[model samples]
Target: MNNNTVDKSVLNTASVKPKVLLDDAPLSKFHIKIAGLTFGAHFTDGYILGIIGFALTILTPQMGLNALWTGLIGASALIGLFIGSLVLGWISDHIGRQKIFVFSFILITVASFLQFFADSAIELVLLRILLGIGLGGDYSVGHTMLAEIAPRKQRGVLLGSFSVIWTVGYVCANIIGIYFADSTNPDIWKWLLASSTIPAIIILLLRIGTPESPRWLESKGRIEEGQAIVSKHLGENIVLDRQEIASDAGFKLLFSRKYIKRTVFNCIFWVTLVIPYFAIYTFLPLILESFGMSSNHSTDFLLNIILLVGAFLGIYFTAKFSRRGFLIWSFVVLAAMLGMLALLPSTMTLLLVAVFGVFTLIMSAVSNLVGVFPAESFPTEIRSSGVGLATSVSRFGSAAGTFLLPLSIANLGIQSSMLILVAVLLVGLVVSVLWAPETKNLTLNRASKD
Candidate 1:
């Protein structure tokens, strides 16, 4: 309940590791488990969001809401997401990453099930707000955990793997939603929504045996606990330079003048990037409907498969090259693709539409940069906070995008909307080049210290 109790645990932890035990310690199974837990936690929420993309249009009519209202309800999730990111990120720093993980997972499980019971617009909005809270917390905790546990050399690639699971989750949701729609089972929609909880529950249960972040432990003056956690992954034989990595100055470290500029830049970057990405993604069904497509479910299924595959391949290339380099290249591709979208006619081209699928995946894949860079940009003390705040603020852009899409489509049509996307992507390109720092080779801890 108090710092004293926590301190007692840390003291005991620090005192127990025998110095002579240093030997060739193999990586613990718990280390691997953390990676899976991190991936699963982030993956589940992404899966749910992807499902909503498939369902947003279907449920709009069923729930007796119009297009604008449906978009607002979806936007509600972004609002809750913004609030949660700020709160939970600070909590991860103040409490611990493990605690946030537990709390968030429980909330997600509850919210996912709530989707099944919502019969009205108000109910859907409330449930979405709750879902957003859990989703926000997932990014904060999962990003921090992955950053902390990964080997320095493989950190970018390993953290990038989370993006891979994200694609998988999105694809799974799309596939499942389409499958249910194809079956004509009225109850299947609820089943699909509720199914998202399975991954969260499994991850939550697995997390029971997972350890806290070693960096966080050390920052809290729990050198022993931190060392033990580190030893679990690094082997007891490995000697760390500092036996005490704790600091009374954890909070100060993030807000110092040195890091304040980094914070401001990140805030701007996060808020803007999600606008175009989600504008296209969340309303893909509506966009397709404007093209005279009949079945929203089928379109979503195909889009998901295409985007998911593209995102994975993009991340693979990003890891293989560098985040900044890959992002620059991707923007060029996306810009060209968005331009091509302007040329797409309603009647003419199944093949052109198919080619458009590749662009959808490209955009989704490239957008991971929006998520990945924040964690790598700040110090351990503020890494979660930085990520959380960035994402939370960015949801404003997302909300705007969601709100604007209908209006944009109304006045400008799909081609104009696609042109607008091209413009937004162009901004992303410029900001990424001018403002966002290249974090391809940096770690939060190391970067913060520099």
Candidate 2:
């Protein structure tokens, strides 16, 4: 409870090997349950975020939104996500992951329901910001919880499945968006936004009795409680091996010499990945139109299906290869695809579509890796904070890209914009080669210590 008491446990932990009892524990029903709950949260996040793409299409004409207003409406949630992840992520470290985890879904549900009543653009943007905050909090907390609980051998696959399940949510939203694209009703966007509440409610219900992270408990010197939770999930046969207990260095520690490299890696890689990713996917309808494809809901729906397939491939390969290897190759491939899109003649419809599909596939794979790395890179004491900062920073990039992309396309044209994204991916590829630490098969404790 106090610093003095926590210090005593720190000393005690130093002499022991600190074996995380659940590190190699067999997959159990509890793991599956928790995975389902966390995955549900991700699914909700995807739907909430993805639905905005179509909603904006409908809202723009109805509201007579100019380019600036359109950009602001699009970027509002991402800005909220930036703030939420930065603030709540740090808060979760002190308060506890479960409380933040549960409350976020509640917040999301409330926000989603409120969206149905929004009549003005400002009101809708405000509601979206609130929703984004909840989503940001869930992103950091859910991934950290999953990383802390999963077995090392399967950690990459399990965490990476967040992207796959998120794609399911995205595809579902696209399906619904396509269905409603032709609706003449002014309130159809409201219905689309409000529908996010369904999964959020399910996640809120499922997370009712979820356990706290044992690593977090041990870090706080609540060893007995931590052990009890571990035993409850991993079985009583497991033993706690004491390892060096890093001090509960607060957020300041993220910038300390020991962690600065990891922090930089997380920020740079994540920002680069999300900037083009959010810009491209969030405005896929527009991008398709630029490519001379019919900018119909059907075309957008087909592209998302390709994205889903790519996400599934990402999940499978995340388990099969080294994190560093997969990410390096993925970035290289993504950069190449972007370059091709920039250079190839737009009149080559079949070739352009084929290239774009492969681009979505590889980009989704790398995006899954982006989600996994930040959670794996930090100690339990700062895991949520580290992930939060990375996520927040990435959201900023996404916001900037999403906001300015229309302007960029207007000024620079589609080919030139694609070239710029190609440059961004090349930077990411270099970072992956120079800085990506090998994280596959490492326990949370072991990975953090690296």
Candidate 3:
């Protein structure tokens, strides 16, 4: 008998008594709450990530920020996200999801309010890092919990909504920025940074009675407790899937031969998608101005509006296509759009803006896959671990990109910056063609293991 096991490997030999186990369970209000909670959490995340871009425009001048300070402020939250996801994400898998679920919002809410009082660039940087850490914990566990609770038939739709929900939050932040943007008000950036508190509090309250993932409990050999929660919330008809025994699912397993390929693939999948997205979006106002367009949040508003529309389109396409096919095709279109942006002079204002809008729409549509693949790729025991590591790695890469974009543009110009991002997209496209899995319709078990 092999002793290495993640959760309930004994279930591999046990028979399920119920006809409708978790995978086939009907969608219920409970599931809706799960989805809603995760969505709200992600929405706050997007707002935090997006609001910094707008706030920095004011903070730079008000605080007299140099390029170095500006990059640190821009990348601070991302670097914090990297740490939070790497550390707390692993802890959640070991300690249980519910604790981290409640604790994250507390951190976010507190950090957001603190932003209103940030007087120096360094103080604001520290506050942003704290905010990012809270979001990092949420990012690690929220999607994992959603995937585990959703019906397999609708899991794609539920988990897939993550990216779009995030985009909507980002759009909302941009809208708010446009509305409150006042060069005369040195205090405007403070309010913008503090606004994140609203969503955090709402999500925290909603999370109060949420149940832990039964599958996670079962994996940890707490079968009766797992059964009790499922039966209590989902009724006796719902049960957990049988898990195979005799495999260690420790974090180290992510680098083992069985998972290393997937670990690398998932990391690459996300890192490429977000690196350019964050870098460009974080400084979008400046980028627009560099293109001889309005930097006064008007053009940014239009781009964000397109992103909002693209988010709904993303929901439809995420549910409609194979994961592998959708990913590869999206990257191709993304690269083409960037190529157009790179070659056409920014002097072609309307044409350049139009191309960028098309790019934003396409990017939003396919970004949904990021939510689905990481959760669906790993088995129950290490699901959050895989997701966390992916989030951590991607945030690190994005932090680098966000920190460097200004420097790159200063040295190479905006067109050259777009071309470098184009190359990044091509690399993702190539990797997707080579290794992206077709897990669109598979059961969580099969998706994770086979």
- Greater-TM-score candidate between 1 and 3: 3
For each candidate, what TM-score against the reference? Answer: 0.85, 0.93, 0.93
Overall local distance difference test of candidate 2 = 0.85
Model 2 lDDT per residue over 142-228, tens place = 988888888777778889999988888988988898899899898999999999988888888888888897878777777788888
Q: Scored by CA lDDT, what does every candidate get? A: 0.71, 0.85, 0.85
Q: Distance (Å) between predicted and true CA of 96, model 1?
A: 1.2
Query: In what order do the candidates fall by lDDT, top score first?
Result: 3, 2, 1
Q: Runs in model 1 with CA error above 4 Å?
A: 1-28, 182-187, 239-257, 268-271, 289-302, 343-351, 448-450
Winning model by lDDT: 3
Instruction: Give lDDT tens digits, candidate 3, residues 276-350.
Output: 888888888767777777765566767877888887888888888788888999999999988998888767998
Candidate 2 vs candidate 3: the lDDT winner is: 3
Question: Which segments of model 2 are wrong by more than 4 Å?
Answer: 1-20, 244-246, 446-450
Q: Assess candidate 2 and give its TM-score to the true structure.
A: 0.93
Which of 1 and 3 is ahead in lDDT? Answer: 3
Candidate 1 lDDT over 1-450, as tens digits, reads: 775566678788887755532112234565567778888976886787778765664666566777678778768777778878878987888788988888888888888887888777788788878888887887877888777666555566556677678778877877776666555555556677778878878877877756788777766677688777666666665443343343445446556888765676667655655776677777776666676544455666677677667767766776777776777777778778777767767675575576577677777676666657777887666778878877787876787788788888988888888788778777767766765566776644456332
